[model samples]
Target chain A: MCEILRLAFAAVFVLVVIITIPTKSMGADKEYGQYLSAECNACHAPSKKSGAGIPSLNGKPVPYLVSALLQYKNKSRKNAVMQMIAGRLDSEQINALAAYFSSLGK
Target chain B: MKKISRRQFTNAAALGLGALAIPNIAVGAKPKVVVVGGGAGGATAARYVAKDSKGAVDVTLIEASKRYYTCFYSNLYLGGLRNYGSIGHNYYGLAVNNGVNVVHDWAASVDAQNKRVKLASGSSVSYDRLILSPGIDFKYDSVPGYSAEVQSKMPHAWKSGTQTQLLKRQVLNMRKGGNFVIVPPTNPYRCPPGPYERVSMVAHLLKANNPKAKIIILDPKPKFSKQGLFMDGWERHYPGMIDWVDPGAHGGIKNVDGNKMEIKTDLDTFKADAASVIPAQKAGAIALAAGVNDGDWCPVNPNSMASKADSNIYVLGDASVAKSMPKSGFSANSQAKVAANAVRGELTGSKVFPARYSNTCWSLIATDDGIKVGASYKAGEKKIDVVSKFISKKGESAETRKTTYEESIDWYNGMTADMFS
Candidate 1:
């Protein structure tokens, strides 16, 4: 009985850690992405249609957004402004942006 | 799959229990935030604080004008590329959708210690935080013979309203082969590329309407923004129609007779058919009134955009002494986000993110010809520092230029919505 109780507590502990870790870092908070998206909204407004060749970011798949941002960061993408903006973003920020924008599509 | 989902829900439930220890907002009284000016910086900040705070903060925007005209694209309107209404933005979206209180009144004075602002209508509003983005005010005395009293005649047209319309009318009315003189202000003016773009647009109008007419720019500074590009575009499109005379060549503008429409340069007195005299500038009068100004502009804490003079006040846009950042709408909008985050975090205990900023200034030399310069910024220890930058190359293809021009049209739509909607 003692061993079984210990195992149950350990499972709860592991699960809590798994779920709460992202919140502690502030990147995974949907609220943070919503706040950060204010910057992107300056150019990619949801209400306004994209101009020139500027593409929309709302409702895009997470993998596609992440990959595109990564390509821009790595200079594989051709746009000068995108490369400059993407170069400043880290992995977590990119993930957060992708997740936030994807969720907005729904 | 059901068992796994049940376990995940249980984990989240336990975490929610732990989060109960954190204090939520006090429900009875909401904090009040007052923003002055409804331009790029003020509108964006007011909208963000209201939207993100979600009724936790009351936001009031006090602007003198009911409609804000963006100076960024006013040059296009001069060349008949865009209509006057196309560049004007209203505050209805901010009021109805975001729940921001939009009051069209001038902020006459700021009482910093009392944390309230007195409007021109004899009404006053109190606030927990104040944001001032009153933009630039010109120093007409900076020029030898220029003053505010004579603006109607020379028509600075720098503020982009009736003055812009007046200048356009003057351009349209000039006689054939007449000269249009432009006297640009010294360094640290609004939109470093603005006077140059004005030259291009004026030249475009002249080339179509009055081919024999000439446009001359008497620049105080030896070199101006996008000099080579503007010169190249001029040669190709409006060859010999424009002459950008540097200080060395023109010597100096000794005096200007607005009544006679003559500019007495050291070289000679050249009478103009019409002229635009953009004088030196200072921070908007309100910043100085609030005692936040260092000399001509207010110093800000780079990370939060909080006024160094007063902690409860934040300054943005042309009124701020943001190091290395030009006084453009894009820069103002970028700074507004940073200030909004800081304001929200302070008043509501929300998580504050690192301050990031970016600005892109696009100029149209002629129709289907556009160029841009931009930089990304990060909040550094002392100031906002540029992380990376890019400018349109000299020899870009015509296709590229056309695409860039189209992109600017898109950016205007997005930016205005970002500020108001």
Candidate 2:
């Protein structure tokens, strides 16, 4: 009986590990996506002009987006707006994000 | 290979382990968190979320610029004491050293109902939580006839980079005894003491070159940061070279004609060889599109800096209305840490931790003379309270000023490291 109990506990531990791993990944995807979007949402919207000052970012190309960011990162484009944003990204994440956004239709 | 029966395998595994299962089950689901603006506040939030949540929380940092230039100590560059390169830095440390996804792009708008952030490139990023720190935007209309086009003629030097450089050049080129006019904005602007610091540094330049040159400060407010000390320093150092005009004295400009280098104020009309007008400001344009900003600034909860207007969004720095915190670089840096930790707690379903913040602003009265103010703060029942505050004591000697200048360098390095490295 003791041996049987030990075996059950080990099996349960392994199961928990498997369950928690995916749980964390899913959480990251959702949460990271949420916070990252808030920054972007400030400028790109589908609705009409939110105000007199801001421009609409409803439809733009992925290549255009990628190029714009790259330029800011490279210092070819001199803008406080572009410089502030592009300075914070990595290559892989920028690519993945670029892919993610490019997939969306205007 | 022979496959063992599921029951047999389970029994074997349990016998080998022998300890309690301790499932440590996940309650519901992990939260999705996205952060915009990779400055002091945004970057700090990303670090906190990544650290506290273990691997449970996801953090994405979207910033528009590839590099960040700190406004603190930028005066040193203007004073010709340091190069601009000394103040510029990248976010590589935040990306490689820390496990963070830093995206370079302008966040166009947030769809609150759908929980989606649309990018300028027609791409949509969905998140359960969003953080925005879009910083400040200049209100062009605040000063009549002052627009982007007129910037070449009369540099604001308010923001960093080219405009700042342009203003510096114009000052350097001015003939001996040329007039330098600095227009200070009304209440609620970024870097309250910045204009005065600029004046002080400019006075140093004139003293070194054209001793006959003079500086005129047109202030909208009656009082300024370290007014007593600044005035005292002026009397001792650049006596009669510095002058001030309050709004009531007809110094406030009603309109600006940039082309002709003329300004018409309520009380007087004047023209100068060089001028700087720091105008009224509001949250960056992006904040308005996200429906986060009211009229002037974004309203956010003091604890987490989450937008009060929207549950999914957070705002920080000069853009957000963190009522207790001043709009200074150091304040922005400290607030970022609080916001980051709060974001981590929310994502992992854990308790949000209380935040204690600190800030110090150092200003140069001359090339060597420096003055500073600092404070520590914590959350009260509903607001933030200053627990401790200090200023440089009476009679700062040359050695102390030199130390302060060196300390300024160290502070800038540490601050950049905290944000990126």
Scanning candidate 1 chain B in windows of ten residues, the lowest lDDT window is B17-26
lDDT of 1 by residue, B142-179 (tens): 88899887788788988989999999999999999999
- Per-model DockQ against the true two-chain complex: 0.56, 0.02
Two-chain DockQ for model 1? 0.56
Name the 10 consecutive residues with the lowest summed lDDT in model 2 chain B: B16-25
| Residue pairs in candidate 1 whose N, alpha carbon or C atoms collide under 3 angstroms | none
TM-scores of the candidates are: 0.91, 0.73
Candidate 2 local lDDT, B83-180, one digit each (tens) = 88877778788778777788888888888889888887788777767877777888888888889888787888777777778888888887778788
Give the per-residue Cα lDDT of candidate 2 at A105: 54
Clashes of each: 0, 46
Best model per DockQ:
1
